[model samples]
Target: MRQYFPSNLKHLCSHYRSISDVCNRLKIHRGQFNRYLAGTSFPTSFNQKRICDFFGVEAHEIALPTDQFLQLISSRTPRPTLAMITAPQRAVEHLRQCSSSRLQDLVGHYHEYAYSISHQGRILCSLVSVKELDGHIVYERVEPSASRSNGSDRTSCYRYEGVAYYLGDRLFLIDYESLATSEINQTILIPSFKTRNARLNGLKMGVTACDHRVPVCSRVVWSSLGTKACGPEAFRKVREYRDDDQELDSDLKARLAKAQIIDGLFRII
Candidate 1:
């Protein structure tokens, strides 16, 4: 049971950054935790309960044979059995299945441009990659931290992972902040109608990263970079751009301008 516990604990910790990170978050002593991982010792009943609670597992479940434990946890993966899903989950899964074909053509990378949620009057350009995984359409949007000091200090990135669905002539995206897990954002875009140089115009709603976390809505433009443009060179280009930046296309700059609210509707046109 103790041997099984160590393997189960290791599996649970794989989802997190590192053992030290887990120890810090769990408020467990590093040396004692290492002993448990090494199978040289086991936690007391109280400490075992704490570990089980932190990992969202029952005490008995963690002590199961390692093979049985892995199988038990694998059942909770994204591809849950239809019988285990609730009505709402079933409906969402149905929608994803129905819309899978429509998203096949949109599986590529793009440069996402929108008004800076943190910095007024500047446009924030981020890298977005959309792909089909396990019969579902998913996307990842990466934005460089606003506090990057002239590239002197390391630039940490904010990543948002979301699902994409094309429904009723509109493209819809809903994502949460993957790093901090503090916020969710939604974007609705009009699908491209033109054959050449198509840009998806949309509106994004998200809260600012500031202390106040004020909710904001801004016009967003996504320009396709094709499938091969999401590597290092593209990521380096992700950051807020001044209105007068020479590299920004004049048309794109105009499209991202602050438009007036007309009759209670914030129009992107």
Candidate 2:
């Protein structure tokens, strides 16, 4: 019944500057918007109302078969536009435009370290790779964990795909957990200005994977592993480690410690 929804939604979005613009207007995550565009999932009734209200169409009308839906909106006026795009949107666009030129130096593999959300008191290391794609910087992160479930060694992997932006001397990365699709993570790191890329430290904000799903914030460190280590061998290294694990050096371990407020300001040193 909703087969036409994807195509109709695409048609509506084509009138905007970009799908990003449409998602911004609808207050939807870009990753979730893509699922609707690809027909892999349907928007909930609440989202349907938001979409319908934004496009001046009825819910039933949007579900019409493509040909009829096209004809229905044929005489519709041009897509609406604000007197000026919001300042935040303009800033985002500017950052996206700047990412391609500014992030080449950081396009490589990294070992991402953070306090484990699933296994408290352990440090988790995930494999991450960043690269330039179509004038935009995109990255993929893979988390591989091994545990004994039902008396058997089972490995569970979680993957995330996200975009990176360098704006105002800081690197911003936002991604949704692709495997679960229930979490969106944001990391803000200090960009490396040195001639050589080095360990970059930042804060990560996201909900835990536990059943309770408590929101947690933790300090994270990205250690450059260069371009060659992003293959299968790299993934082998993605797992949790004890605090005394030799792989986690003293300096790196120090950086990932949970932060505390000092003088009314939270700091990750």
Candidate 3:
């Protein structure tokens, strides 16, 4: 797979001091850092995390195989049944049609548990938390690495958590949610991005499981005008509507419908 470490090294230089300085702070060998910059070597999960933390970047941003490599690997891996790939793609397409504002809002709220699939076929999903500060949102994802010379890597993913989020900045995966929750304080913020909705839809489409529900104060939906206003019966109605479907529960259906409406409105406006 094509390596992402070189560009990540450039990103590090923009954010930190010389490679030697970064190595010292990460406690990795300077030579290793040089190799990383040259794309001749990759940091173990531990170092990848450390460098990411040091530069305040996501672990996946630095660790995920480059596009060329991912494509190559995916091609080599046996293709899933045609049904498997198409379903997720359709669901993602439905999500993309959502309002930019609501999408931005949802991402800000549940930035942690949100997953984004790009047009380029890259998938970034989160199992972490969202932090809101000074009107800005921060999403973080942490992955464990096998121990290496730099001690284990400690990089994490950070984003705003919505369809509108930048692909490069917002995509990620956490190696272990329990470990991340224990290490950091995870708080649920405002449920604006219909992240709850996306989660629900993901379940319905079989892209994810129904059990992956995130707690929300209430559910909201989009009006015909494509404005994101609160709906009193929307959540309940969603529940009632989905109650009949064998694959989804009333609660999940409600969440998914809310997300779809919001996402649809996002696209309309």
* Residue-by-residue lDDT tens digits, candidate 2, 14-57: 87899999898789999999999999999999998888877878
Q: Which candidate is the best by TM-score?
A: 1
Candidate 2, residue 217: the lDDT equals: 79
Q: How much is the lDDT of residue 131 in candidate 3?
A: 42
The residue-by-residue lDDT of candidate 3 on 68-164, one tens digit each, is 4345434664433212335566455444443233324334222122212111111122232344443333444332221211233433323222222
TM-score of 2: 0.62
Per-prediction TM-score: 0.66, 0.62, 0.24
Candidates' lDDT values, in order?
0.83, 0.82, 0.37
Better of 1 and 3 by lDDT: 1
Q: Considering summed lDDT, which 10 consecutive residues are worst modelled in model 2?
A: 144-153
lDDT at 99 for candidate 1?
72
lDDT ranking from best candidate downward: 1, 2, 3
RMSD of each: 14.3, 13.5, 21.2
lDDT of model 1, residue 48: 88
Winner on TM-score (1 vs 2) = 1
* Steric clash pairs (candidate 1): none
What is the Cα-based lDDT of residue 137 in candidate 1? 86
Candidate 3, overall lDDT? 0.37
lDDT of 2 at 125: 86
